[model samples]
Target: MPPKLSPSGALRFETEEHTLCGLCRTPYKSCECKGLKDNLHDWYVWHGVPSTMIPSAKDRIFVGLPPPPDNSSRTKLVKRWVSLVNISMIMGHFDANHWFSTKWESLNASMDARTKLLNEMVADYVAQLPTNTELTVLARVLGLQRRAIAGKVDGIAKEAWAALRIFLSGDWACMSKAGSKLLMNAFNTRDPKKYPRDDPHLERILDSGVSRIYGVMEMGFDKKGYCLAMEPGRRPCGVGTSTTLETSDERLISKKARKRKTTKESIPTKKRRRVES
Candidate 1:
């Protein structure tokens, strides 16, 4: 007799480590494991999944870099997508000759205004994507630039660009520490104001270079982990916790005060000695 099914419809099978297929739970002697595995492989292949892709951890679903964020690959895919979109957007603006210095108040105001406009546009475009569209299709569509042809192609290109922008923004919402650092490094190394010439470091170079264009560095994360780029000068940001945000200035001031107190208490006062001729 066949084993009974659970209330959830899962098959209850006799598990034998040496004899049964873990997934379909069939006995090895007569198992169709090869067919099942091949079917799975084929499905992924059809879907254009990379062989190197592995199942992400449950915590990864929550988003952002893992706690330490240093030298970690646990959230590489999302980070990579976000980074790519960021670089592309920066370069795109430069290509359009929208050059602005971060130090300029007028430019900062304009950046904020443009960000809001772009985000709204991106959302509208993402909503236009067909519900049945596959993730691979969405990714590829977002990667491509819109054609400049008049009418139909132009309309479609605008939508695609918007979708790409939306996707990038969504991924960025869960920015990890590593992701934040990666972006900062990319901006610092790539901006003409910072490098002005070709970067020598290969790894840094990989993050740098978005053409001959120079742009402002409005976005960044403070030590408290706030995205200064988006919000700009807002302070007293909270970290990963849900608690009340504290002023970063206060935090820095307190640290400085404590250091001064410690130095006054710990170090012996140096005595000035008169040099005998």
Candidate 2:
């Protein structure tokens, strides 16, 4: 049966140290209902009760049946039991002597790290594009806000992932949700058909540690992964290199022109024509 709910005034804990909880029937210090009053909604929902309804103190749940209500007291002590349940879920138990626990915090930390890395990679990639083209790609293809292009790390990360997926599909002009979904399925199923083409640019991004792009690209591993704008064994063709090569070729051609000899027409050609006439 459910525990009796007393009027708010009679539920005070000051003179109730000896009085057991009406729900758990345990002393105040040892009561299992501690620290759950604030999370009443969570507790009720967890017990399969509608969020709009107030659950009974002794409601049954998948976790187990509730303790018999203490008829001698009239305080609603359901909160303490919910607190214990929440704590148990948080603190995973041991099987035999081995302790097993969830790494939710670590997973989040890793995701944050990847998000930061992807933001940097996107910045580098966008820098290589023409000024007008960069703006168009940021606005149209990736749907990035102006502030995102201005060093907003989280926004940059999101834009980079979208751009990378689009680029993998050979469509740098627009982002495609279909492409992104296929890429996600590739990662999940390890199917090459759903993966990106064997383009060098796409491969470079995939091999790098921008995991947020694919959620499996561990870029900062061992502190020696390739950046999005750079690739191994390939020198970047910058303006300086092109200018230097052009100047050297011009000099070589000028030297060859200077060395060429122009033979003048012989006057004997005219004499031979006169003799024949």
Candidate 3:
């Protein structure tokens, strides 16, 4: 039951005091049927039913849910009911906390604070790269490779925790029934064989939040805790999650040719067995 749009004539709130919403039967000033969600889809799903219909858990999820604590930063603030234990926790809770909703605005403020000095440092480092000019690279170097294959996982234990956390949380709604079932089994049994590693992309999903060749490899809703394309190494993921309607790369190895030519100082010799003492 979507928000009932009266066919004939909807009740007009003429700034009248104590005017109850015609749909929810609650005061127009405070309509619970409108729901606590920020988006229309959630409202349609959870609060669409009229006041006459019995409200389910979806309708009552935010009835007593507390918001994030007052703090300058999410990292510093202790988590509340918004743990990654369940995906439904995202609604009316995670966004209100500022961890995922307005993270970019906060990050941008921090970037502006030190961009000038940081750029100066980056440029200075870039100049130091061996055979600095790109034109010279056409001769000696074969090709540049991303650290993807060679990179090491940041922390194996933490990576597993993060992957399992996402799968457990209600975020699996978007996934197919079969896929979700498989993920559930893999997580539940704690068996690597249960995972569909042959999928190839499975590795990246499990490695979410762990460091890759670039920054944190990601596959979910701001799992890195924030989203920003700060460097060529790191890029933003959940682009549209932000509430605001916003208007808003590196070099390779370095080496220097030895100035003085030197002769071989040492030679390798095969070890001889001492048969006789």
RMSD of each predicted structure: 26.1, 35.4, 27.9
Per-residue lDDT over 106-198 for candidate 1, one digit per residue giving the tens place of the 0 to 100 score: 432333334444344334433443332342332232222232223323333343342223223222222322223323333333335433435
The TM-score of candidate 3 is 0.18
Clashing pairs in 2: 32-80, 33-80, 33-81, 34-80, 209-218, 209-219
Model 3, runs deviating above 4 Å: 1-98, 131-142, 145-215, 218-277
Looking at model 3, report the run of 10 residues with the lowest lDDT sum: 257-266
The 10-residue segment of model 1 with minimum total lDDT is 56-65
Model 2 sits at a Cα RMSD from the real structure of: 35.4
User: lDDT (CA) for every model shown?
Assistant: 0.28, 0.28, 0.24
Q: Model 2 off-target regions past 4 Å?
A: 1-107, 131-277
